[model samples]
Target chain A: NAGVIQTPRHKVTGKGQEATLWCEPISGHSAVFWYRQTIVQGLEFLTYFRNQAPIDDSGMPKERFSAQMPNQSHSTLKIQSTQPQDSAVYLCASSLDSGTEVFFGKGTRLTVV
Target chain B: AQSVTQPDARVTVSEGASLQLRCKYSYSATPYLFWYVQYPRQGLQLLLKYYSGDPVVQGVNSFEAEFSKSNSSFHLQKASVHWSDSAVYFCALLNTGNYKYVFGAGTRLKVIA
Candidate 1:
């Protein structure tokens, strides 16, 4: 199994630039999640999708952060005007269903200068 | 508000030594617990999980965890660790109905060969 595939293992962007991270979940998975990992916050939940629909996104920043699951196979997290505070490991994970264990992607390390 | 706490930011041990990592969660009602490990430049992998029965649950790589509902704690332990066991370990909890997994900050382990 390929597990979960994330594109662009590392991403670098300048201030005010937009950054988009992509995640391809395991086949047959019905749930996808987005999380941000930092030294301070540790690991924080950003958003989650179930059956390709946005389930909960309370953890997402009110502005400049959005996520979408246009198709069942792939999901994307976009951060507009990426700032230094936004620099962290953006991790994407998927689970077989809403009530099953989740598998995580290698994650995209974003560095905002 | 739901939250998880991993008191130890880092734990060091020698190879072939027993290991124990502490974890505590704050949530109401029955909670599903989980332990995951992440190696360098890799995604987090499920080590083990606990729901009900069997306070002690075994996971892959000879890892195990004990759930203490009264104490609201779920700690991960390994009988013996190898150099390959050096990684970051995270503890998580899920709600009974919705599978909202909340993760702790994570404990980084360093094993000396």
Candidate 2:
């Protein structure tokens, strides 16, 4: 399996611009997770979806960040009005089930300039 | 709320030396503990996991972790280290109730020859 696939290994967006990151989960996996990683904040959970449905997004910034799992195969995270503080590695992960081992994709590094 | 803590922010060890990376967690119910490693410019890879039964669990690359319910800790260990083992190690706890992973502030390991 290709594991989880995240598009755009790197992205650079001007401040106030919007950025959308894509993630294609492994086949047959029922759970998908998004996390942000930076030197200051090790790893922070952003949101998650189960079977194409958003389960919890408590960690999300809420104001300018949003996530959607349109189908079983893919999900997307969109950040509006990006700022330098938004720069970080966005990681996507999937698991066979909620309680199973999670496999991660080579994250997309978002650099807001 | 479930949480994880990795006390050491960075650790350095010589090749062939033994190593231990500490982790402590807080959760009310039985947790699914995991250790993941992140190489430079790469994604997080699962090293090991523990749910129940044996307290000591084995993982990839000669790595192992011992879980202690009494102490609320799951510490990763290696008998001998190689330079390739240098990476950031993260301790995570999976909350089965919500199926979300709470991660620790990772510990960076630098193996020197």
Q: List each candidate's DockQ score.
A: 0.82, 0.91
lDDT of 2 by residue, B12-105 (tens): 9999999999999999988999999999999999999999999999999999999999999999999999999999999999999888898999
Error of 1 at A52 (Å): 1.1
TM-score of each: 0.96, 0.98
Q: What are the per-model C-alpha RMSD values against the true structure?
A: 1.2, 0.8
Name the regions of candidate 2 deviating beyond 4 angstroms. none
Give me the overall lDDT of model 2: 0.96
Chain A TM-score vs. truth, each candidate: 0.98, 0.99
* Stretch of 10 with least lDDT, candidate 2 chain B: B94-103
Residue clash pairs of candidate 2: none
- Candidate 1 clashes between residue pairs 3 or more apart in a chain or in different chains: none
Mind giving the per-residue lDDT tens digits that candidate 1 earns over B1-113? 67789999999999999999999999888788899999988889999998789899999999999999899899899989999999999999886566778998899999998
Residue B88 lDDT (model 2): 95
Q: Candidate 2: lDDT of B51?
A: 91
Per-residue lDDT value at A2 in model 2: 88
List residue ranges in candidate 1 displaced over 4 A: none
